[model samples]
Target: MNEPMDMEAVLERLKEKGLRLTPQRVEVITLLYQLSHPTAEQVYSLMSKKFPYVSQTTVYSTLKMLKDLGLVNELTYGDRSSHFELTQEEHAHFNCKSCGEIYDVDVKDAHQLQYMLHAEQGYQVDFVRLEFYGTCPACAAGGKSEADAGRTKQ
Candidate 1:
């Protein structure tokens, strides 16, 4: 899995991609880096509190741009709203069905799996999605779930 990226490097990438560096965009990136796997609505709510002039449309547009630029990853849930994170490494996800939490899971043999599928099954590999759904530890303990716990597990 990927580590925390340097903001300066991210800015450089933005410049390389010909994306204008704006205050709103910076805040959006910071928020996603700070609060991993946050929904667009969650971002809009917090951004409104910090920068009242920042609109929901701006947040949506910023997220869209970030996704298109591969600076962020969008984690979608079947039963709940989608979440976004700055962790863009090739890792799998674990979704807690009971508590609605998403955990990052690193697949050590992801490349091997792709190779096996392509060589053995004659299936072309494009993108792979690996996610596990189950009850989190805190949910098993009847308490709030900690995102760090999931991160540590991986």
Candidate 2:
């Protein structure tokens, strides 16, 4: 897989788009690029550790701005909070029902799927999101699902 984009280039792109390079923006960008998939609250929590003065509202606004700029993608997993990630690459995601973790998986047949859809239905698609829901190997082996563990403790 290709390496994720460096934060420097991202910041430069943001600046090129007339957005100020504020410290809060930097923190949010770093979190979105570093953390696999984080929600606004998670980004704010991490930013608070580094910049205690940062607020959740700031993080939300920054994330919204980034999304508007097409620099990030907002993903929804069931009823959980929305997760944000850099839009540097096109890939599929595997949602682990057991642990609620999202793992990236290669979409080896994306092009084929697109072709099939167009040829079959005479449609043109811009982008596709293919997500699989199942238990990850770790959870299937010996790991207890989060809900199961919580219930046992109760």
Candidate 3:
């Protein structure tokens, strides 16, 4: 994977997409670029620290706008909070049950999967989300707290 993108490049891309470049929008984009997949509350909290005037509602709305413009993707694994990430690459996610960490898994057979879905189900799939839940190596080695066990499926 390439290095995390800079804010100027992100801002330029947003402008190309016809989005207005406001301070609130820039802050939200910066947080998303830096943190990868973060929940709205997480973005709001970080923005609040640096920008006391930035509101949660503004962040939420900005995220929605970015998503609509195909600049960002949203993921929800039935978790309490929705996660947002930049849509620069396509990959699946592995959610560790014990550590509560989300790892990006490269999809070597994405085209095959898409072909099978289209051939077998006759569904024109525009987007796909594949999540694998399991105990990561550290958690399996008893590194995580006991309370974290069995929280997700493998």
Candidate 4:
């Protein structure tokens, strides 16, 4: 899943999972593969432009199905709506505190930590999802929003 999947690859995955294919579902999978990280609403919005009668339920259900099948991962940060991305190699995520942008961060140290815990504590390693919060370069270099203007370092 690290590599971007073509339409046939996506369809084959759905078929392997015993899921029926429909035009709307195919569109949803296409968006999931194309968009960097999208919420259910964003998927619905884009699909609506093409399929005017598509329902939010359809979008949510499809996302749920993808997640259940392990083809996609859902990232939940605080109270915000979860974001979806194709399943990929383990990596960390950075959340820009000011603008709420999420970026993928390659962290070799994460693997080292997992190895250490497994070797020393006899704990089995599953998966790692580390979230770091900070101001992105754009927001930190004197590009603060009006609301952020009132905040200060303690």
TM-score of each model, in listed order: 0.84, 0.86, 0.79, 0.81
What's model 2's overall lDDT? 0.78
User: Root-mean-square deviation of each candidate, in angstroms?
Assistant: 3.4, 5.1, 4.9, 6.2
Tens-digit per-residue lDDT, 36-89, candidate 4: 667788789889999999999999999999888878899987697798877778
State the lDDT at 48 in candidate 3: 95
Which pairs of residues collide in model 4? none
How many clashes does each candidate structure show, in the order listed? 0, 0, 0, 0
Off by over 4 Å in 3: 1-7, 141-154
lDDT digits (tens) for residues 42-76 of candidate 1? 78877898898988899999998888888777877
Candidate with the larger TM-score of 1 and 4: 1
lDDT of each: 0.77, 0.78, 0.76, 0.79
| Candidate 1 collision pairs | none
As for candidate 3, its clashing pairs are none
Candidate 2 vs candidate 4: the TM-score winner is 2
Q: TM-score for model 1? A: 0.84
Worst 10 residues of 2 by lDDT: 145-154
Candidate 2 Cα deviation (angstroms), residue 70: 1.2
Clash count in backbone of candidate 1: 0
Q: Rank the candidates by TM-score, best first.
A: 2, 1, 4, 3
Show where candidate 2 strays beyond 4 Å: 143-154
Among these predicted structures, which one has the highest TM-score? 2
